[model samples]
Target chain A: MKRRWRQLIYLLTATAAALFMFLPAAAETPVEKGLAIAREADARDTGFRDSTVNLLMILRNRHGQESIRRMRIRTLEVEGDGDKILNIFDSPRDVRGTALLTYTHKFGDDDQWLYLPALKRVKRISSRNKSGSFMGSEFAYEDIASQEVEKYTYKWIRDEVYDGLECFVIERYPLDRKNSGYRRQMIWIDKKEYRTLKVDYYDRKDSLLKTLTLTGYRKYNNRFWRASGMNMVNHQNGKSTRLEFSDYRFGVGLRDSDFSRNSLKRVR
Target chain B: MGRPAYASAAVPLALVLLLVFFVSRSQACDLSGHASVEGRFFFRDALFPGQEGNSASVALQPEFYHGRRDGSGLTFTPFARFDSADPERSRFDIRELNYLMLGDHWELTVGISRVFWGVTEFVHLADIINQTDYVEDMDGEDKLGQPMIHLSMPRDWGVVDMFVLPYFRERTFPGEKGRLRTQPVVDTDRAVYESAAKEYHVDLALRYSHTAGIWDFGIYYFRGTGREPDFLLSADSSGKPVLVPFYVQIGQTGLDVQAVLGNWLFKLESIYRTSRDRNFFAGAGGFEYSMVNAASSGVDAGLIAEWAYDERGEDASTPFDNDVVLGIRLALNDAAGTEALIGISRDLDGGDSMLSLESGRRIGEAWKIALDAFFVIGSSEGDALHALRADDNVQVRLSYYF
Candidate 1:
């Protein structure tokens, strides 16, 4: 009996020593881990040009009623810190020779240009408000473009489970002093892929304003993850906007020369 | 090859309905509406040309509404003005009384509203019906108050709207101590010289909007004549015209399109109008009646490239119409409404160009103060400037919003 007790005590001591060595490491805060994961994911694909196609439908509320109006478009994206996006329309209303180009920067301001086929002219657009709805739709101009890491000051909030996967919740606040439609945003980043699965936006008064969801992430190139669709629902206005991205191709020989102001005039 | 900016009324009523439902409900019900008062106390620098005059004006703008935004709301807005520079111009203006449904997509509004029309360097929309031209210093003229009805629906697929503005009444009250000139009336084109006793008028418009791909197309049509009141005419004691109606139109039609794809933006607009009789200073009779048949069409396109010095760039909340515009606008963080804009434009006619510099600052969030100094370079005969018979006009203005 004494020998058995001695053996049990010895086993207990070894188990306690092993746990003592691993507990502190397992107790790392979610915020620190989330930030590190996001940083690493952003670094993996820092520079690339992508081409995509999308089917667009603008549903307007006329007299409080809704309907679906269809449109198709092709897009070219050059991502740095901010993203440079160009969209060309196809099908419906026969606006065959129209082009829209947007250059979005991370810390500075964004710029837009349009080419008209009938007049053969190009115009430059200013980027003053990123919060204003895009083309009167629920999605703002800022919502459609690239989201840089520096636009907001992030704080790690907590760890939670979403869609059966572990996630880190982070709060992001705009560093800008301009009047904003929202105050802060809470995002849920997946721990595994670092994909943003959901976001809750607060208004200037810190009231919950809107919710955005990114769904259907598909793994690309064995390491890259991309969201197939995104949706934003305005809590105050009871309106929602959805974006579907398709036919994405990566690593095209797109150059900065393709994104010049003079190119707006020559767009076909 | 495209429709003019002033095409037929293609804005659907559904769009207005959506707008009424969403915008009115965005803010929780407070007092429904509020009152705003503002004045511009200008101290003219006598050393400057054309600006050697000082002026002060006091204005009382009140807005009132009844009923909850969820169901039935009726809003009324009225304005009263007193000016030291023009004591003869003391007046009261009825801005609007717009009514909307609780949860539906429809609204009925009565009073004066700016009609959505025209696209030059700036945007001019219908239903923005307050007058601050002399103070704001923009070139576009003002249309006087008229009893009207407006309806709209704000949605995504398409929008429809309709409006009827009646110019039925014009009764000038005698000044507290002076005789009233024949209750002034503006007759089509004849407003330049002759003054009429009072006349009836009517304006009706319809608009439709639809989205196809990245393109938004709006078609609109407006028909009316002799709706501008004579009291507001910029004329001298002898009725020597201080300004002439630039277009000869008893009726006008327009079409406009807005498209966006990536970084490229395109806008196409076209307009046509019916000819009317006009009065001009022909050197002999001071003014003579002449039939003028004319129409003008213009288009503007632009492109811009945006780049960032750092990987993590910035995001902003303000919207600047950079497409088709060539200039720089700077706004300081500490100054909420303060901004400086420097602009240059190459005229579509390949004739003469224009340059404008403007600045606006706010004393507070609710009050905005602005100054505009404009210069037109390479002016030629028949240019926009020479056509308007004006040059280098400077203006300063202040506005308060509730």
Candidate 2:
């Protein structure tokens, strides 16, 4: 009996050692699980909201010279696969009257339309080269705020402190060259909330081209975080554009019909 | 801060070739190219005197590339052009034959190629990198082919650009007496000697771009010189090269400045020449050559203004003469969410006034078309005039980029 007890003790010791070895390589940790939960909080919220933004764009050449123009935008954003987006603009001189329409999609290309008051005609814009510029701004159409997770391949590079908040630094590479103007991007996700605090864009040349900053996060439905303002500045060019979203409302029974091309003319 | 190193267009090509080689050796890669053929039809209401005629031409541009990361690479851009209406009767031409030698931060290109220099609508002496736009004297289409060696840095000191061409091709002279005639005539036979007298030249250029406090800047400079045509050259026996002089087109120095504020963009350019000659205008139209001739000085200047919104796109081409302009651009979507644009431009030159407008719409997912119409509101004389009619020209283009 004494010999058997000794044998059992030795066996238990070996088993404990093996289990310790595998622990470092084990499943997700509570910290990681907590981070994911934060990310899903806002992502799962299906809400409807109307927002207005005022943007200004300016360009200067090699000489110390200046020119200016103004833009006004009204947008309605809703959560879900078939969310609706309507954008109306007040163009500067020479541009006079112009309006735009966009329908968001979850798994495919979105629908778009433009109305020319001069020609009294309504036209549809395809998704080809959707990576092109948006309103001569440094931002490409895809560069605008579309947080579709599947559009990119993400890797958690590390957990680090950023601006007083612990954040996950996730590196994302676009999966489809056709849909992206950027080569790759790195984003900072706040540990407490999935709200992106910052983003860095790499150009096709794999050069760090632009940086985006998000601020003024307000909680919605006690679960979602929304940024009231965002700014993107092109590092190569001395140009910066800012967007301010206001008057947010969510979960107001929105549907696909609210975001159709036919509905653009009817929107205020 | 150190200047960013730039690889030539070769890096991508090399990456492709390496991928191909690796593929043959059972490695993975991606290779793609677009093959296309384009044709143009020309109808002339008057050829020198008065007659209605039609002409046609076909062109093929083929691009090929192969390479891999940190490895050897190769790219070929070859073109063939054929025209039935060439006044000089040069029916077929090979426009490009280039080979690239690339390294990290630097790219060397050697052989025949076309270099684009200016950013204006109407052609000027400053736009001499290639002769196609200037070769209207060849009757239907002009072939501005040149043999050259070039160095291009994709990125360096906040600037990306190219250096190229060491010579000029002499095409036929439009003749002196024809200057006063509404419709001029050219001796096609004499045009043969022009290309044979190609003069060697070299151009060095650099572009630096930056932005400050809501404004962006685009700065550029070009300097070079060599032999060029003389407009006074007679078709007679004493064809003593009248003005076959070699001087500056971009002068020994050229500078351009562009700025953007809000939705507005402003551009200004100036060139300083050491000496000016007449042969530069030999084969070009009377009105066209005069602007280049007017600035037979040490310096010339140009300027422009532009405004645009998401509702439309603007022309990349700059117009000719007076060096100054004002313009606006707009883009808007429909009540049904379609894309459309409107644009307007005005020339600031004295009296040779011009106004242009353009509009485009996306038909569907596959194609979008735009129509551009321009008219000369006033006329100028004695070297600054553009003999365009009030109801002048229009261009319609349909493009699809997939």
Candidate 3:
């Protein structure tokens, strides 16, 4: 009986020791760490319901020429799927009253519609053109869409400081390689808020193409964090775009119907 | 003459009164407007006797809206344009003077408004709501807003819209001095109407539309005076051979569908129309495939091909009957918003063809420049476009938007 007890204790000790060693080893791997961080960030961003924001985009060329565009964005979050977004332009008189509707999916391609006020018609835009610039801005269609966690695979690099704040430096590779313009992206996310602070995009040739920086983050509804300004600079072209956001309203009772094609024409 | 003058003055007086009432009563009313000045220069000389080689125009479009947060609104949009070269093109229209009320499952609109329905790129075979403003452009995209009471109801199946058109609008035509015209000028003052009610004939339209997955479908029916007029060769008071437009009653049924799959878009538009003179069917089907970021650049290029068919064969009103169109579109994806498109339509019955090129780019912030070129070649003598075969021209337009 004593030998039996001794054997059982030995087995318990061996199992505990194995777990102690394996847990740290698994946590030390960058892939696992990165996935955990992404999951946490995604969880923290859930349940936003809906949000509306006004944006002013300033574009600058290599010669320092500047132009400005104004638009409004409305978003509705869907559980277990991607979000629905509506964008309405309010400036540059010619494109005024133009609206774009997007329905993103967690997997596969997204659906997009462009309503041209001049033609008084809604055209179905190819969502495969996600890599193309949006409305002459430096931002691509994918950049403005609600980023889905499943669209990429993540790998944690190291902990670093960005803008004087502690951040988790991670790398993410787009899962839809053919449609994505970037080969990979390195992101710096703040530790406390899990809000993205900076991102560096690498081209298909694995060369640095653009860098995006976010600043002036403000908390909304005591839970959601939003950046007030974003700047994207193209390394090759020496051109840049700055987005300034204002007039954010949350939980405004936006429903699925409000994001429909019918509502696109009615958007003021 | 006295009654007509009074009726003309009453419209403006009523509009002014409505504007005053809305502004005084609704605190949430918003008023906005935009003015554009455009200059168009044609490369070719005048094709007709009284036509000019260049023109300048100014347009003002103002909108007034009074609404609450619940989507109930009264909107008035007044559009006016003055052309220096073509008096017939200079006009004023109440584009949308309507009262809109919305509910959870239904919406209602009353007054003058515009509705467009079609999917194909080469031709809009299913669009039949508004009368064509022919003098505005040859593409048949510009429309004169129609006076109607529209009601739409949304259900699990689809959205159903019913329109009660209270009046008919005469299709406008190019003047004698216009660049694009027939062999004989059309006498708009002597137009004939099939219905004794004339312009007072009430029309009706119904449409059901729905979208599923990547496909959108619509079915429509319209019963009214046909917008396309059949001409009768007659002599005017001056003893000149003139085309007298005859507006006939028609019943039309239409279908439009679009499917978006990956980088490809397929569209189809079909219509069947019947009139006292003849019954016929027309259709247009096409596809557009795009290559995003072609050759590692930010430019997007799209290839478009479409087939258009009409049952009337050689007797069809337009030259596009039984034709095929192929085109390419290029989007620069630059800060200047540059885009260009080139298309060619070849008539299947003959070797006749029409080639068109359109390009536009923004200048700085408020200015835009557009270039358009059209060439008609090898047209048969009997073809409608044969009259203006030498009218091939290139136009450059510069516009300032505010």
lDDT comparison, 2 vs 3, better candidate: 3
Candidate 3's TM-score reads 0.94
What lDDT tens digits, residue by residue, belong to model 2 across residues B15-53? 546645655664323232222222222222332433223
Clashes of each: 108, 65, 0
Index of the highest-DockQ prediction: 3
lDDT of 1 by residue, B94-206 (tens): 54445544224444555444433322233332222222232213333333344567676544456676877654323222121211111131112323312231233455778
Sort the candidates on DockQ, descending order. 3, 1, 2
A1-268 per-residue lDDT for model 1 (tens digits): 9999999999999999988999788866665555565576577656445544564533333234432223333334544456667666442222334677777667666666666642334544545445555533556555566676666666688889988889988887776636245588898888777888998988767888778898878876565677877777777767666666676556655444445433443232
* lDDT assessment of candidate 1: 0.48
- Candidate closest to the true structure, highest TM-score: 3
* Model 1 alpha-carbon drift over 4 Å, by segment: A1-268, B1-52, B86-90, B102-105, B115-120, B123-136, B141-145, B153-157, B168-199, B226-249, B276-326, B331-337, B345-354, B364-367, B376-402
| Interface RMSD score of each model | 19.2, 20.3, 1.4
Q: TM-score each candidate.
A: 0.44, 0.43, 0.94
What C-alpha lDDT do the candidate models reach, one value each?
Answer: 0.48, 0.45, 0.84
Q: Candidate 3: list runs displaced more than 4 Å.
A: A1-28, B1-12, B24-34, B37-54
Instruction: Report how closely model 3 matches the true complex, as a DockQ value.
Output: 0.66
Question: For residues B141-200, what per-residue lDDT tens digits would candidate 3 score against the true structure?
Answer: 888778889998877678899999877777777666666778687777788899998877
- In candidate 2, residue A60 scores what lDDT? 31
Over A109-226, each residue of candidate 3 has an lDDT whose tens digit, in order, gives 8888899876678888889757888888788887888799899999999999888999999999999998899999999999998999999999889999999999989999999999
